[model samples]
Target: MVFSNKQLLQKALEENGTALTIVELSQKTQLQVAKIRQTLTTWEKDIVRIGPQTYDLKWRVYCGKTFRHTPQAIEIEKGILSTETDVYYYLIASFDYRAKITLYDEDDVAYPLTDRKQSKNLKLSYLSGLSKWFKKYNFEVNDDILFTCKDIKTHEFKIRRQKKQERDEFIIAAKNRRLADLVYDIINHTLPKQEGDMFLIRKYVYVYPFNDPVPPDGLIKVLANNKRFLISNIDKMYSWTGHRIKDFLTVGLRKYYLQNDKKDWIPVIIDTDEFGKYGYCSQCSERVIWESDIGWHHTKTDFESAESYIPNEFFTSDNSKTRMN
Candidate 1:
């Protein structure tokens, strides 16, 4: 197997403790110095330049927790301070503590955050955070701030707020969304960690949209037609289908075409970084305006048009049949 550029650099950094020059790294890895420099620039989070020609691996002393590339925990706290679902607390450990989170505001600040699995109720994890920080951000019930775990050992996390247009914070509510979208969000969320990644349709009829529940028949219609949520024939269960293109925090750094309401294919330049996924429309400014593998929908207060995607989170690459998400 061939070593990737990042792998090569990581090996060199670990062996030498990051005291090598570009020329030395090139010789060790049998790569060009230009390539070495480029690799360092691209993977600076792993390997950083200390002095002019010196470098070091950016690692922290921690407990014996192996790191994994985890998806950021979205909708960390749905601004409403309530215990709505049992699944809400396990939301982080749902993926084996492999989650990162942060909240966006008109401005940003950082605080120490931690979660404790209660000895009394093993199922519930009591999250202790800076309650005053929420007040400082002035987060209304409509806003969502995702708090990502930076270090499990130290329980330290950072926060930042973007310009309103390029915000990671989505100021939206369920009632205002298209009826189809409401069902999608509810079912997508309520899908249990079961055999099929599915949810029972009738289970949520009265549970979803707490203020006003979706009609059981209409909810079935949304699930039946929407390709984003797939229906199991035998069990009559629903799961998030593999048709989302602009999955905000999960799918990253792939090119896509947004089919607007006019049916024009506008090329989208999507990219990913430490913060989160970004770049949907030249005009949308980091907003994931496209819907799952069907059509596009701007998720601001008022959503318009009917659309889906040809490919979504698990889409075929331009050059090959391999899936990228």
Candidate 2:
């Protein structure tokens, strides 16, 4: 029977129990090789490619309840649904309700405190006196597991520090894979790869917040210190060595900007070089885009409905608006 891509993927994952290879999937689904490759890349959230052509489904069920609340502290219980192993559970006791708490188990693995619409009472284990853990992250703590607010930037910096290595490796891998794929595409057409081609690729992958190719000085320093990208030895250019592409791709997907109240960084599509640094108001569909030198300007135009609030071509000197397949 013919199956949709999602259906086929779900079946293969269910049969394999969270582990499968590209070759095995192709054999089972009888889909074209290109389609399988596309599936693997597209199913990033559902499956993690642990090895070459091998994937692991990161499936987990979460349950959370607000157990108790008082002026001083709030308590919560979290449960996980896993058939293969024991269902995980934890009790979180927080002093400050405003400051979000991320619960970490004995193994130092963090479990996000998420909302569950329906929950049943479950006896869960508690890891006590973990205030020092939060303190290490610069979070103010009154007692065990008690949390208070700090500078948002400071908190983000600490969190970034904790995941720096993993993020860097992912960025590097993505950059390399993308470059390799582009080169293959070019070679298949028998076209010479120019130096400008590499910059174009970098620009595509790392969408700068500005009209110019140059990224903010602060952003470059962060990428360089984090070892995600390397400074050009010859020209005044920022080259993506793959260290922090995640930060770039996900720039406005979440909180928009790292600093300056979402005005510090502008977002855009790396491929089209089209500015994505604008947003529509939740109250209405009005658009906003960042003006060079000036801050964000709210326009009457809605970017989604129109050809872009701003044009792709930045200037007469810049021919980096070229698109790649």
Candidate 3:
């Protein structure tokens, strides 16, 4: 299998006591001098380029371990030719210790800046000036900077995923609104100011201020539930019936009832022939008993203390059969 030429070169250098020239490395690895020079420039962290064609493993040291001013190193130190990510990568690779790193976007206000007067001759823009400022600050770069990049990438992905999920949930909620809530929304917002009969059909469900007649699916159910109106021949649009006089009274009462209670605005009185005499309490499921025979003639306050209603938090830890306390 083909192997990494860079790895092979570093292994050869490690084996030798201190250093090797380009010709020596070419002979040892059986590679061409041209290939050796390209590899040396790319893998400068692995082998310190000592001369035009000579090299030494970066770990190797003589008496005092002095720095080598190689032609490539000199070019890099002068900032004549080097990219920012490349500079960061080289520093982290060269240093053995961990270091904290912070990354800033080009437009971020937190990034360091140099005086425009000082940088005008160099023609350094805000972004380019950051690199020069970093060097002047004597900041030690290390491997942790790569970890910071990974952390930023992961956080950005989570933010995007979360936003998408929230948008999906909002779309679902709008599409699947409860029938009761939809009716409430219409009465509160869309029923129009100047009124004759406001007829609603499936097409005009929320497309309010419309006079057209087309039965939308679930609209008949809303009409039937409102006790003020008597419904007959529900399936047949032409034969459908309503008591206009009763609707006028109930619709007005409903406006007042809704102000106090947000629940469905059903009046306490209605035709005995249509809706039977027995009305079940929502909380208890027992027949709601009216204190006076008159029924809805009294306000909502009269029914608040009725015995038929169930108490709040009905569940008890004691037994299976539900009982009111």
lDDT, each prediction = 0.38, 0.32, 0.32
TM-score of 2: 0.29
Ranking by lDDT: 1, 3, 2
Candidate 1 per-residue lDDT, tens place, 95-134, comes to 2243433323234455434545545533333444546665
Q: Give residue 266's lDDT in candidate 3 (0 to 100).
A: 30
CA displacement after TM-score superposition, residue 207 of candidate 1 (Å):
37
**Better by lDDT, candidate 3 or 2:** 3
- By lDDT, the best candidate is 1
In lDDT terms, how accurate is model 3? 0.32
Q: Can you write out model 3's per-residue Cα lDDT over 1-325, one digit (the tens) per residue? A: 6757787788788887667888888898998888877776632444656544667654342111111011123222432222221222222233321323333342332332222322445432111233442343332321011111223111110000011222243432333233334444433343221111222222122222111121111223333444322222221111102122332111121321111132233322211333333333322223434432122222245454343232222212111111111
Q: How close is every model to the real structure, measured as TM-score?
A: 0.27, 0.29, 0.22
Give the per-residue Cα lDDT of candidate 1 at 161.
Answer: 25
Where is model 2 more than 4 Å wrong at Cα?
60-102, 105-228, 231-325
Off by over 4 Å in 3: 61-325
